[model samples]
Structure formats: structure tokens, C-alpha cells
Target: MVNDSLPPNQRRFFLTIILGGLSTALAVVAGWPLFRFLSPDTGGADVEIVEIPRASVDVGGAHFLTYRGRPVVVLQKSAGEFAAFSAVCTHLGCIVKWVSDPGEFLCPCHAGRFSTDGAVLGGPPPKPLEPIPVVLAGDLLRIG
Candidate 1:
């Protein structure tokens, strides 16, 4: 018959090992999703919509707006047509600047440049700017 009672040292050692294993397993399960959530870009699957007032933006100009308090760039193509893209640079997290003279978005940190259409013309950026889907409903512009 197995002894039901053991010395204090033996009991403590077994308990510690069991607890350690449990802790490690718990960390692996919980940490994976947490790390992914905290990542800057969760791939291209997640897209959202943002709205801006028509009068608030200028034609041939890029407006820095916010949606849900997150920064975004709104580009006015004409009187009512507009396109939107995330201000975040593809190369790095640095915010991109809209230079009206060249009709391009420039990342000052690394000289990354993106055309008005969000195409990466020249720079270290691996991909073109992230285009946010847009729709104009009366005076409101929605980007997703």
C-alpha cells in the first residue's frame, strides 16, 4: 500500500514541481494571445472605418484626423471624393507627413515616401501605405 503520509520535505518538493509545471503551462496559454494583441499591426485582416466632415477637409490637401482617438490621414481627391490611409508608416511606427508640394506622404524618421495614392515610391518600406476603405455619405466620409 502507498503511504498516505510523507515527511514535510518530500511533500513540499512534490508540490513545488507540480506548481511550477502548472505556472509554465498557464503562461504559454495566456501569453500567446496577449502578445499578439499588443503587437502594433495585427496583419491586414483587421480594418476599421473612420468618418470626417466634408467641409473640414481641403481639396488637394491631406488632413490629419482621428477615429476612436487614433490618428489617421484623410486625402481629399476632389469636391466630394476622398481616400483615407493610416498615418502609421509601414517601415516603422513613426507618423507620416503629408507634403502638399509633392502630393506625397513622407516619413521623416527614414525618408520613406508614399504617393498621394498610398503607393510606396521610394524608401525602406516593405509595402505601400495601408489604405483604409472609404465612403462619402453626404458631408461625412467613412473609412474602414
Candidate 2:
């Protein structure tokens, strides 16, 4: 209770300070719970699967497949395991071509060459192709 006997100016100053502190405390309390709830959950160790099939891709050959409507390349290795990577070239975003003769994925626009394992072998591309995670699920291959 404010003492009505207090001078008006002094009472106003004290009331203003108390209200400001109350508002700040209320805002912090309200904001903290929301922040904790809304923060991104990035801690899981599970792989997110994209869909693919168990068909054999020939070595020195490339097959283009779509996952989530995005283009990906399925390459067969000399060791017989299939590896999937994004078809988009790291150099200038051009689509890469599978050059069967040299057994390399080639980006025609910049002469960039990537090995069957998605390693950048030559020209312009500063990094390897982005590999999509693939796993065998029964007869189907799941990619992510």
C-alpha cells in the first residue's frame, strides 16, 4: 500500500521504479521457458532415411535417382558396394556426368572430375561431392 501521505512526486518515482523492475522480471521469466522449449533439438544420433532401391548400379556407370525430388547419383564401386551422392557439382552448381570410360564423375561445365567415391580428383571443385547416407532396408535402399 502506498501511503497517500507521501508527496505525489516521490510516490510516482517509487511506483515507476517498482513497475519497471516488475515488467523486466516478468519478461525474463516468460522468455526463458519459451526459449528452452523452442530451441532446436540437434542431439540425436539417428540417421534420417531417404528412399532408394536395391538395384545394382554398374561400376564405371552412373544412375540418376531422385530423393525428396532432389537429384542424386548412385555410383557402383569396383568393390561392388553402391555409394550415393548429390549430382550437383560443387563447382558452379552444374550437373555432373558419369564418364564411364575414365570411371569418374565429370562436371562438363568446368572440367571438374570426381572419383567414383565422390572425391574431387581434378579442376575447380574445392571439395568432394556431398554424399547421401544410404542403407539397405530389406530389398530397398534407404537414402538420406
Candidate 3:
């Protein structure tokens, strides 16, 4: 509360200081939850499986790894949706590179193009990329 006995300038200054302090406090309180969410968790031992963290693949990005002694790729189509494909090109068995700008997979050897869903889009590829079984479990992707 403003003191009635204070000069007008002093009263105004006090009110401004009080409001500024309260607003700063409220801002911190509101921002803490978001800050916590964005921070990385510090605990947990590494558990091995044929599993990968879902965050490892960004939107429209691909994760490449060996599955069953063959090169494989996993792509995140959208939020929480994923697809896996054999990385080998259908025409010449060459590895396919993901071209995110065009949103297609390109075979470096033959210029073969394939859609994210493994459909043949262009070039000399004989067929679509082979798909692999994938299961989404919570925060990890279990691929076979």
C-alpha cells in the first residue's frame, strides 16, 4: 500500500518497484516448469536392446544402422509416426541417401529416387525399398 504521507514522486517510485519485483517473481515461477521440461534427465543406466530413442530421429530425418547384417534406415514421418526400410537400393543394391529437401531417398550410384514410404519416385530403380517391421514402445523404437 502507498503511504499517504509520502510525496507523489516517492509514492510512484515505490509502486513501480513493488510491481516490478512481483512481476519478476511471477515470471520465474511460470518459466520453471518449461525449463525443467527442456533440460536433460541425469539418471538411468544404459539398457541394450534392438531399440533406439525416438528423439534420435528428427522430423523428416532418418536413422541408419545395421539390422540382420544389412544396412537399414528408420525415418520419422511425423510426430510419433515412424517407418523403417532396407537402405539398399532396389535396382543395384547400392545404399540410398536421404534427400530431405526433396523428401526422398536418392541412390548415389544410379540416381534412383524413392519416396519416404519406400515407393519408387524416379530413376532406374526396379521397385520400392523393402520395409522392415517396427514397433513403437513408449520412448523407444523396437525394430526387427
Best by lDDT: 3
Write the candidate numbers in order of decreasing TM-score.
1, 3, 2
Q: What TM-score goes with each of the models? A: 0.67, 0.60, 0.65
Cα RMSD of all models vs. native, in order, equals: 5.7, 5.9, 14.4
Clash counts for all predictions: 2, 1, 0
Better of 1 and 2 by lDDT: 1
Off by over 4 Å in 2: 1-48
**lDDT tens per residue, model 2, 72-130:** 88876654477889999998999998988868899999899999789999999999999
TM-score (C-alpha, index-matched) for candidate 2: 0.60
Model 3 lDDT tens row, 1-144: 457778999989999999999999999998999899988754332322368888889998999987766788999988878999999999989999998997889999989999999999999998999998888999999987
What lDDT score belongs to each candidate, Candidate 1 first? Answer: 0.83, 0.81, 0.88
Backbone clash tally (model 2): 1
Show the lowest summed lDDT stretch of 10 residues, model 1: 41-50
